[model samples]
Target: MSAVTAPQADRAAPARTASDDLDVVPLRHWGRWVAALLVGLVAASFLLSLARNPNLDWTTVGTYLTKDFVIRGVGITLLLTALAMVIGTVGGVLVAVMRLSANPVLSWSAWLFVWFFRGTPLLVQIIFWGFLAALYERIQIGVPFTGWHLVDLDTNAVVTPIVAAVLALGLNEMAYAAEIVRGGILSVEDGQDDAATALGLTRAQTMRTIVLPQAMRVIVPPMGNETITMLKSTALVSVIGGRDLLTAVQSVYAQNFKVIPLLVVAAMWYLALTSVLSLGQYFLERRFGRGRRGSAGPGVISRWFKVSAAEGVAR
Candidate 1:
């Protein structure tokens, strides 16, 4: 056989300047000044409106802020968010792993879980769980009629508002969390898994040791987003008579008849809570983005001044 000719090697390409490679332009600094003015004006207008409300009960607002009921309600809200997110994150990991599993049964079950939870409204789920006992008067846990002293799932006993709230929030959050986890896992390069396998790691071991740690870099931003969402969604527990932050505000407002003021209190708490979480999310995202390549983060000013001034010219 004739000797095969060697193929010519291709040279590495040069890096392109962003301006040359893409049709993008930075905004003028004057646009930033305009945005600042607009934000200040809106805030000032809102404060002025609050000051003009003659029916506003500052005393009641302050009283409710310090009241045990409101305090306890807020505490419960935080607890529910924490518990639900923890349960949801755990469930999400399982669901995501199952979804990516080779086993058809596991994949199907996980798919069904995500489909059903994501399809239904969270409020409906909360209501269903709250009234689950109404349908099955009592859930028996014993083996048939053997009475081996198993558990009894009485609706009245087991379907308390708090229990129902946790179940609803956890299950609802699981669907979204699953997607977040799946996306994060997929974002990892295939080579990472291959490399782990080459080192004599089983698939599960590779995932636990190699994949998850890398995936977390992508997972944390969305997790923070979900945590914040769950915080607000905890308010829905109020519909089932679970007194969370919003519900406590509602109770106070209903009795005192200072609707807007009481609502303002609730809004304030939500703002404070979400703001703190938002700051935490920013820092967490920054931490996760370290050592990563381009666009890991936009500068704080850029983050604030992202939109074009003309886009909101009429707002």
Candidate 2:
């Protein structure tokens, strides 16, 4: 057999065949498209109807949206959220640690705290704090069974509406946050603790430096959600006249008899605030999820949108 030279063989390469080319057709989910269209239409119709309804008093909504009372209420709401979240987060970590401690007393104490707070309704707790004076007219601090009262204060003066609101929200949130933190801590592998021990690190040092840092990947998403929930839950403070956003709106509507419009204003502000918090949460989740299993730089929503776009192009 005669040997073929490299260039001669290349010139004799196999011809392109029709079978090699594929005309792919992506499957269309018609039901999804129909459902999405129906939802969009209904939402648009509802919005337009609200816009055209004179009873809604969109003008009143615009009028009081940025009024001084409403603005102050917004500030108060933000303050309550920040303070409550701070208290909850700090107290949560402490409670979680206690719950995990070797001592049964510490663990039982933490459990009882979480159980009581979680078991009761948060609104009831707020009202309880608001009217704590009803339960105890005076708060005395001193040696028990001894007639020595170092500090004595009226309950009403000490636990004002704002104070009551903070106490209620923070303590309630601490219960839930305790569980979240405990779960996160537990998510860290036992081997990690073993490794830390082998490295001659104390338990506290191991947790503070190695374990907690790793557990943040599990902790941050739920904690962010809890923060948002705390923001919304501040509305309940209005019952005690804690001067939250809802309280300001209620005050105006009560005076002017424009309940719906004022409520619309409050709803708008709440939606806006929650949207901002959700955006921050998305970023935080993305940050913490880095290098973790099943974490691909982008988040679920972003990935979903990308996938939908690619599918659209394919179609």
TM-score, candidate number 1: 0.81
The residue-by-residue lDDT of candidate 2 on 88-138, one tens digit each, is: 999999999999999999999999999999999999999999999998999
Model 2 clashes, total count:
0
Model 1, position 249: C-alpha lDDT score: 82
Candidate 2: minimum summed lDDT over ten consecutive residues — where? 291-300
- Model 1 misplacement above 4 A: 1-39, 144-149, 295-315
Model 1: ten consecutive residues of lowest lDDT: 4-13
Could you give candidate 1's per-residue lDDT for residues 1-315 as a string of tens digits? 875444422224555667787867787799889999999999999989878777776776777766788788889999999999999999999999999999999999999999999999999999999888889888777777787748766677978999999999999999999999999999999999999988999998999988998998899998999999999999999998888998888887678688877777787788888999999898888788888885356767776676655557757
TM-score, per-candidate, Cα-based: 0.81, 0.90
lDDT of 1: 0.88
